[model samples]
Target: MLHHLSIRNIVLIEALDLDFAPGLGVLTGETGAGKSILLDALGLILGMRADSGLVRAGEAAASVTASFEMGALAPDVAETLTDAGVEVEPGEPLIIRRQLKADGGSKAYINDAPVGVALLRELAPFLVEIHGQHDDRGLVNPRGHRALLDRYARVDSTAIEAAWKKWRLAEERLERQRAIIAKAAEDRDLLIAHLEELVALAPQPGEEEELAGERATMQKGERLAGDLSSVQQVFIGSDSPLAELRVAARRLDRIAGEHPLLEEVLAALDRAMIEADDAEDKLNRALDALAFDPLALDRVETRLFELRAAARKHACAVEDLPQKAADMRIALNAIEGGEAEVAALEQAAAEAGRVWRALAEAARAARTEAAGRLDAAVKGELAPLKLDAARFRTAVTPLEQGQWGAGGMDRVEFMIATNPGADFAPLAKIASGGELSRFILALKVALAEEGGAATMIFDEIDRGVGGAVAQAIGERLARLAGVGGGANGGQLLAVTHSPQVAARGTQHYFIAKSSDGIVTRTGVVQLDGAGRQEEIARMLSGAEITPEARAQADRLLEGV
Candidate 1:
């Protein structure tokens, strides 16, 4: 519920502050008494587009702030606030502020945190609904009509959600099939080219790495072979010096005991012979390692070249060639899978089409039933508003396939006939300003709880209406505030000029203009008992309030 509103530097309003309460609070004033300005201030905070022209003549900026107590907010609102990282204390006011600068830019804030204009717009429907002759032309909007039908039909949200789920499931299956179909339609030339490359390469996982290792070995083989042969000749080759060392060591071993000094020399010679023998054994191993046939080297080189050529052809590294081959295989497989997927998706799409048709039929049927009741209810209100001769009807038209959308396959619009002989036409095309207001009132009364918002505002709801019709409007507005026998159980604020409308309010405020010639300003004054009577009387008798009008105002307010 909106708890407080503050305006600063707006056109004709230098500064203003207003505190609103539950039930219906009416703002009453004469023509050009700044009543509309007060509502405009409220609209600014509700995310309406800001114009620099709205700023006071001498001010650099204009701002409006609206405070709402969201302690008992709807679940969606709570989640929204939670996601925004704003704490909503049980009794705390959620303050929204919008400011426009003379520099032609505007800013908005929620709970004192700067926010984008998008968020402010998103929050608008949840906070208030301002209905006036010119502003609330939405009563005739086809989408609004469809929404009302759904609301009055008592269509369970769960059922609608389930229907959407069914539609989505079918849609998903169809999309999957379409993607498959597209894949299968690829030119055969492309597939053949890809397949031929993979087949020619005949690559396997890890093959490139193996060939690389073999190629490296072949590249270094020439130098290694020479080194190994030289080493082997020195140690283990039959015509090598190592053989002479062995014979020398044997002679030394045999003569070691001939002399004491010769013993040390013989022992050293024997050790040398042993070391030389070990070196010969190692050289034999080296000779074996370098003993590759020419054909083997040729084969390794050929395989490495093949692998390198394939890598170049595929634009990949030697090691990545194998993986690329696998990828190609997958693409080829997709060529086959595409046809099968297309069939599946085609079936799914057909099923989705069937499901949507059935659900839409059911929704349309529900709307048809609801439309009759809706038309009857609104028509009932017309007589009291002095439109007994008027005819009201609801028109529902189904889509011709191309018009399918998230909403459904049908369009609903409220049609009206102002006179008995006239055929019912779109309300917007036929109804006068006053008629539109009353029609909206009837709809609001019928669908009060259907919308998810926790608050409602009716700006000048009683405009271009007076007498008993004005009384009916007041009664309905009061009903919205739970002032009538039935409890709408939401806070409502109305700006009005009708005495009956003003009398229906649990809270009343008088908005008037105050000027010092050089400076004109707007002010809102909360009225007490006598003040309220005077205002209501003024509404009834204009600037020259008469005794009879005052008496009538007192009686009207007393009844309320």
Candidate 2:
């Protein structure tokens, strides 16, 4: 419930502090009495857009603060505040303040701690709701209708939301696979050609470098073979040194027995012959090491050329060709198995769709049943508001498959038929401004505790109605305010001009403008017993508090 509202330097309001009670509190004054200014100040604290023009003349800034007692706050309110990083303690007061500079810049605070405007806006629904002739929030907006219906029906909304997210996730997975299949289908021929080429080439890792090195060695060996051949001739091939040395050693052996010196010369000649034979053997091995089949060189060169050409075509080093080939094979494999994968994805998506439809059907049934009850309840209050001939309904229209969302497969709208034989239309389209206010009041009355705001404010909900209708509005407002009830009851505040309405308030306030020669200021004071009677009488007689008006005011207060 709203515990207090304090304003400073707001338009027409220099400084004010107003404390509120739980039950309906009424603020009444004549035209141009700054009632709208009060609501504007309250709106700022409720996270409404700021305006520089709202600052009082000669003031540099304006500020408004609304304090709420949180003992009766909705459970979600505390959780939401905590999630937004705002500390909330049960049984403590939650203070929301907004300060607007003359430059149109603004700042907001929750519980005396600085916060963003969005956080303030998030907290608004939990604390208070203000309704007026053109109000679209609370029960009027279609976006909130589903939740409202669920709240009234006492249904578990999280179940529907969880099921919807799962279904949507499944759909996303299926769509992703479908996109892959589509792309693969477009490039199928190209992938198949690349795979076939890589397979036939069968490039082995490290084969390119090995073949190039071998070819170069062979080419160098060809140049060195000429020198090896000449050395071979000196040792054995076509060379006369080994034959001549052997002949010289035989001659020396024949003379060795006759002369000792000749024997020494024969031994040296034999050693020379042995050395020459060993050198010739080594030369033969060297020539064999240098030998190669002429065609072997050509084959190596051709294979190296093929590998380099493939490397260039693929725009990678020769070493990376193997990885490229592997990648191509994988792509081809995916294409080959794509049809089966797509079929599996389609099956999964179908299963998810069935689950979503079943859940939506159950939710729809619950909503349909709840809609009937809500429509009946709202219409029940219409007769007392003097709209007995008007019809109220909760129009639950089925949505197309493409339009389905987390809420369900239906769109809920508050529809009304204002006159007999008239077709039911949207509440906003068919109801006049005065009729809309009354209709909203009927909803508020019917909803009762189901309307979640801890504090509900109606700006002249009784406007343009009088007599019994005005009295009914007054009674309903008092009931909503929870007059005489303890802290557990909700709070209501109304800006009204009807004397009957003002007389029913548990607390009454008078809004009046006073000027100090240079500037006009608006002030509000809680009316005492006699002051309440006088204000009501003034509302009844306008400017002149007549004797009959006082009697009527006495009668209204007596009823309260």
lDDT for residue 514 in candidate 2, whole number 0-100: 95
Deviation of model 1 at 505, angstroms: 0.7
Give the Cα lDDT of each candidate: 0.76, 0.84
Question: Which runs in model 2 stand beyond 4 Å of their true positions?
Answer: 70-93, 111-123, 185-333, 336-344, 449-452, 484-488, 544-555
Candidate 1 per-residue lDDT, tens place, 1-560, comes to 88888899988988788887778888777678887777777778877788898898988999998898776777777787777766777778889999899879999888878887877666777787776666543455565677667777865535555666776777786676566546644644675685577678676777867866765665566658877777667865565687777777678778878889888887787788788778778777765665666788788778778878878876888778657756766666666676676677667667766766677778888888888887788777788776788888888888777776656778888888899899988877777766776676776776665664556666666667688888888888888788866656678777787888889998998888878887888778899999999888887787799999899989999888
What's the TM for model 2? 0.72
Identify the leading candidate in terms of lDDT.
2
lDDT string for model 2 (1-560, tens) is 78999999999999999998778789999899899999899888778889999999999999999888888556677678877778877688998999999977999988878888888778778778888888877767767778888878776777778878888888898788777777767888987887678778889999998998888778877989878877666655333667777777877777789988888888888888788888888777767776765799999998888888988988998888889988877666667887788788788878877877788888889889999998999988999898999999998899998899888899988889999999998877888877888898888677665756788888988888899999989888877677655333678888998888888888898999998898899999999999998899898998889999999989999987
The numbered model that scores best in TM-score is 1
* TM-score against native, each model: 0.78, 0.72
